[model samples]
Target: MAQPYRPDDRSECVLAFEALEGALRCLKDDIARTERRCQEVRRAYRQLIEVAASDAELPRVEPDSRLYRLTH
Candidate 1:
């Protein structure tokens, strides 16, 4: 079972706020790094798909069509 909530003293409350701010800053940095990595992965996947689409065995798609945009 969880303990009942208790209010902190003034100094403790200030420390808690500092810790929370530090954690949020770290989280923002982590999110930015992950987003960049995801973009790289997406670009690599698109390149592979383009190569597969160019193969003679596959049917060709119209460049101007929505289907082409969806696949690539």
Candidate 2:
């Protein structure tokens, strides 16, 4: 059995919408933070690559090695 539509239903609907809007705002903030962190990681990776390239003493990773596979 379903309850008949009433004036209180409108208020309940409004409250649900407000809650969803708050959740959406939080999600947007999380995405922005993740994007910034990804940019930072990319910058660090580039710097590391540059440093490694300048240092010939570092042992070269074999193409078949696990480290090479994980990185590439």
Candidate 3:
């Protein structure tokens, strides 16, 4: 469903156009940042897998017993 172009009101139309263009510019910036973050996550996963396969300083994850939890 589309409407016909009625440009009798020029200033208002210009303002609306500027606002929409600004919004689109901000959207593009946000999208680029998100893409970068996604790539970084992929690289981190690859590094984690490499470390796991080889001998690396793995973080110590100690499982606590019921008594240990009660004390702490």
**Highest lDDT, which number?**
1
The alpha-carbon deviation from the true structure for residue 48 of candidate 2, after best TM-score superposition, in angstroms, is 0.7
Extract clashing residue pairs from model 3: none
RMSD of 1: 4.9
By the lDDT metric, which is better: model 1 or model 3? 1
Task: Give the local distance difference test score of model 3.
Answer: 0.65
Error of 1 at 71 (Å): 6.3
Every model: Cα RMSD to truth: 4.9, 6.0, 11.0
- For candidate 2, lDDT tens digit of each residue in 1-72? 323345568987776777778889999999999999977876776667668878999776677976454345
Query: Candidate 1: deviation at residue 36, Å?
Result: 0.9
Runs in model 2 deviating more than 4 A are: 1-8, 59-72
Which of the numbered candidates is closest to the native, going by highest TM-score?
A: 2
TM per candidate: 0.64, 0.69, 0.64
**Displacement of the residue 5 alpha carbon in candidate 1, Å:** 9.3
Prediction-by-prediction clash tally: 0, 0, 0
- The window of 10 residues in a row where model 1 has the poorest summed lDDT is 1-10
lDDT of 3 by residue, 1-72 (tens): 223445788876787778778889999999999999977876776566556657656643234644223223
